[model samples]
Target: MENNNFLLKINNLKTYFYLDEGILKAVDGVSFKIEKEKVLGLVGESGCGKSVTAQSILRIVPPPGKVEGKILLHQKNGSAKKEPLDLAKLDPQGKKIRSIRGKEIAMIFQEPMTSFSPLHTIGNQIMEAILLHQNVNKQEARVLAIDMLDKVGMSNPHRRIDEYPHQLSGGMRQRGMIAMALSCNPSILIADEPTTALDVTVQAQILELMKDLQAKFGMSIIYITHNLGVIAEMSEEVAVMYLGRIVEYASVDDIFDSPLHPYTKALLKSIPKVGKKAKVRLDSIKGTVPLPLDLPPGCSFYARCGQAKEGICNKDTPPLLEAKEKHWVRCFLYT
Candidate 1:
């Protein structure tokens, strides 16, 4: 029974890292909502806490990383009285969060090689995930793993399944990761740059595969990526992150067509277009992203935002305000 209402609602999520220098606010008061079968693109440059936000949802933040705020999850039942669970309040190592981890929500990491154990076979890993989540025999789990491998477009599924992580190519490894993540048919999937290390063609294939799986399973997705191209391809909604906060959030069409925030506009302009003349210099967002521990007090993007209004953007932090229906921007210009 799928609930058409919001499957996940994250309000004021703050995941801070306790560094020797000071506290690094990785995810600072972030908020978003996702329906049952939609993709939310979490886009930003490196160190913007895109991955941290996803990890926080899964309560997978490493030691010294303190998380705060609410992560509300609404379980889909065949009734109007579906209960929403606050995932943030749950103990980090408790069984409640663990119960939902792979059974209802699963995460596919950025680097599949690092995610998988070197000593374990691909078959063993996928089977383990299946057996842990469901009451199935080893043979049944093995069959499920092979079926998932086939579904993910891995050729020679059985043979590939028996192989170690080192034996597969980068794209194949990513497919294996996807297979494992989707084995349990989770309601929500968090893909942390699933296509980062692949070639353009392979990346397209993976994106298409994810979309196909989403359509098949009706699963909501939170895709974290630095690549705007990938976000535009796979996401329905987009949240542009800067430093550790969301600077802009809107539908994908709105974002690429009429980006409100300066950072979002700069990201769109940075992309190289086809037939735009050879040797033309690419436009880049000026300046580098500041370190997390030493973020600017006002808008984190003030240093690089071309449309930043004089002192207004540098002195006071801007609140994320509703610019239009479903479009939100956090900038003095919008405020």
Candidate 2:
């Protein structure tokens, strides 16, 4: 997406985890911008650092995991100059980052059960988020929480507000998590595989709910998922990541119709399509993701890239080159 109206600008972000063997570059030099009220799809296989990039924006990486590079937040004031708060430079316990967590930037995790407090009632958790972010009384927070629950399409929201997480259905709990995330009307929302654990029908329902809420709230979204189908439904612009770097980025239609990068093409071909001659075979990418600690010297996908050239692909890292207007890919073939 265009960076002119950017809400969150992440430049060359590197989040490294210090391990016994060496530093594991979970997110290495990842860069992307999310514009105001736009959806940016981050599609990749498992361990491709999509989730790590989202977490880095919020500065939520656990201990021994260090993050670097500029994370600029564009304020609502319509100024080109970014807020002085560099997310990477913020102290872990500082008030600036803490103040922005639930209010300015919120995240919806893959599993709601794991995120929710098992002992606490759903109402209590949602109320806590509201109360912490806004200077509202207990009664006001409860009312706001119930209103949010209703907004997220929960049934009998007032009654369900008092119920524990275990009492709600899988879809309901997912809705509840979305409700909590939106309670403060954050400027940016990072949804990390929000529908992964739900049934197909429920997944559609949750996706619809998220889109509706996005329209209502006008918040930027960073949708991180492995499913290209979900990316097609939710995002306007899509970035295909391999290993720890973005291999291709373009509008959703462009990526799907004319994918430039070999990895992106392979992923699209691997998807099962209807109305096609039923093949006893399905396309699959060979090999597994390389270990983060000992990534290949050059392009991480060189080992499995069918289009890889002998010396060029394995000797030098390819820069992200423009393939078309507003379309970019990292490969020697294009450069």
Q: What ranges in model 2 sit over 4 Å off? A: 1-4, 76-84, 272-283
Off by over 4 Å in 1: 1-4, 76-80, 272-283
lDDT of 2 by residue, 77-115 (tens): 546765535688888678988988989999999899988
Query: Could you give me the TM-score of model 2 versus the true structure?
Result: 0.94
Question: Which residue pairs clash in candidate 2?
Answer: none
Of the candidates shown, which would achieve the greatest TM-score relative to the real structure? 2
- Residue 22's lDDT in candidate 2: 94
Q: What is the alpha-carbon lDDT for the whole of candidate 1?
A: 0.86
- For all candidates in order, the CA lDDT equals 0.86, 0.86
